[model samples]
Target chain A: GIQVEQSPPDLILQEGANSTLRCNFSDSVNNLQWFHQNPWGQLINLFYIPSGTKQNGRLSATTVATERYSLLYISSSQTTDSGVYFCAGTLQGAQKLVFGQGTRLTINP
Target chain B: EAGVVQSPRYKIIEKKQPVAFWCNPISGHNTLYWYLQNLGQGPELLIRYENEEAVDDSQLPKDRFSAERLKGVDSTLKIQPAELGDSAVYLCASSPGGGADTQYFGPGTRLTVL
Candidate 1:
């Protein structure tokens, strides 16, 4: 079983600020995806970046597979951005998509 | 297109009672998964189905947990005589087929055991 660790277990930020979240895994990954669990308890897909970088709106993510780490960036955050962010990965097979403990983010207006 | 659909957004029952959750994956998805998520923790895979076959259920507790994906479209997970520890969120996800692909998750069923 692979171990996924997310840094900054909890975070608080003023609206319009910037933040970065990181995730580290113990082994190689076949795929990696970033998700946001909203207040309504919906897992919203943020990015499906297995490697390199991809950006959508004020958010972006990068995964360096060789280093077994991924970074998520949020710029000019808003109150709507407050949620739990999770990074999940699969091994060679899709049978498992291990997730990190999650980074809880709170943005104040 | 609709995302994953799950019924009974929340359920509360006494210990030892049997509970079931249902999930309908995307119209074309061939792979389905069930995961259990504890409070303040990440989700753990319970089982995975490739079409109508149960491919991996190593993490599923066979004694009380059983799941089926009949006809390869919809699935149901049953937990009989559930314990207090079974109180958690049950999440269902699906991908187009299998292997490394993005998974779309349904709004989970929150189970409360008393």
Candidate 2:
């Protein structure tokens, strides 16, 4: 089983601000994904970066396998971006993913 | 893609009652998963299926929980004699089968056991 820890349990920022959320895993994982649980409770897959960097519009993520950590960057955040951001990872040879608590983000209009 | 489809967006039942949640995974997806999410917490895996076989279910509470993936397409999770503590959001997700594939989730079914 792999353990995951998310930093800054809660964050509040004004619209158009930028923020970085981090996720640290106890060991190297075969799969790492970032998800956004919107206000409607829909879990939206944001990124699947096992390693290296990937960008999806204003949302980008970078994972360092050697360091066993990942960072998610949100630029020009909007009120609609407010939600719980979670990072989960599946260990080598494992089928299930262990999840981190989450980072609660609130973007004020 | 239509993503994962789940039935009964919400459910409310008395303790000891039986309730079931249905899930239809994305077409062609061979791996399906069920997760439990408590309030203010991330989702936790309850069971996983690779096609029609249950690959991982050690985390499922067999005493009251049971899940099945018939014909390798749709899934059903049932809880018999539900308890008050059984209240939570049950989420269904699907992947393309590779161990490293990304999983997509449904909106989830919110259950409230009185």
Candidate 3:
């Protein structure tokens, strides 16, 4: 089984700030995704970047498959951005994904 | 397109009681997955179904946990004689069945055991 580790287990930021969360995997992965679990416990799909980069509004993510790592950026963060961010990965031919602990982000007004 | 659907959204039961959670995946999806998420932690895969057949369930606690994806669309996860440690949020996700296909998740069901 592959291991996934997320950096900065917990983060606190004031509104309008910026931050970066990172995820590192132990091996190459065929699938990689970043998910935001809101306070209400809904997992929202943020990105499906197995490789390359993608951006959605104030959120951006980049995955370097060869290096087995991914980075997520939040710029000009808002109060709504407070949640737990998780990075999940699955290796080729594997049916299940391994998840990192998560980065708990708290954005204050 | 609707995302995954899970019910009853929350549950509470005493130890040794039997409980079940249901999930309906996104339309046209061929892969459904069940995951368990503890407080302040990421989800861990419990089982994965590839259209009526479970291809991965190694992580499931077979002693008290059972899951089925009947007809390949709806899934049910059951825990008989549940214990306190079984309390967690159960999440359901669906994918289009590809190597890197995007997975859509539903609002998980929070279970509490007393």
Best by TM-score: 2
Better of 2 and 3 by TM-score: 2
* Per-residue lDDT over A9-101 for candidate 1, one digit per residue giving the tens place of the 0 to 100 score: 999999999999999999898689999999778888899998999999999999999999999999999999998999999886544789999
Q: How high is the DockQ of candidate 1?
A: 0.76
Considering chain A alone, report the TM-score of candidate 3 relative to the true chain A: 0.97
**Which residues of candidate 2, in runs, are more than 4 Å off?**
none
Please give each candidate's TM-score: 0.97, 0.98, 0.96
The candidates, ranked best first by TM-score, are: 2, 1, 3
For candidate 3, write residues A44-77 as lDDT tens digits: 8899888999999999999999898999999999
TM-score of chain A of 1: 0.96
TM-score of chain A of 2: 0.98
Off by more than 4 A, model 3: B98-100
lDDT of 3 by residue, B8-109 (tens): 899999999999999999999999989999988889989888999998899999999999988999999999989999999999999988443678889999
lDDT of 2 by residue, A37-101 (tens): 99999999999999999999999999999999999999999999999999999998886888999
Q: In candidate 1, how many Å is residue A75 off?
A: 0.7
Q: Which stretches of candidate 1 lie over 4 Å from their true place?
A: none
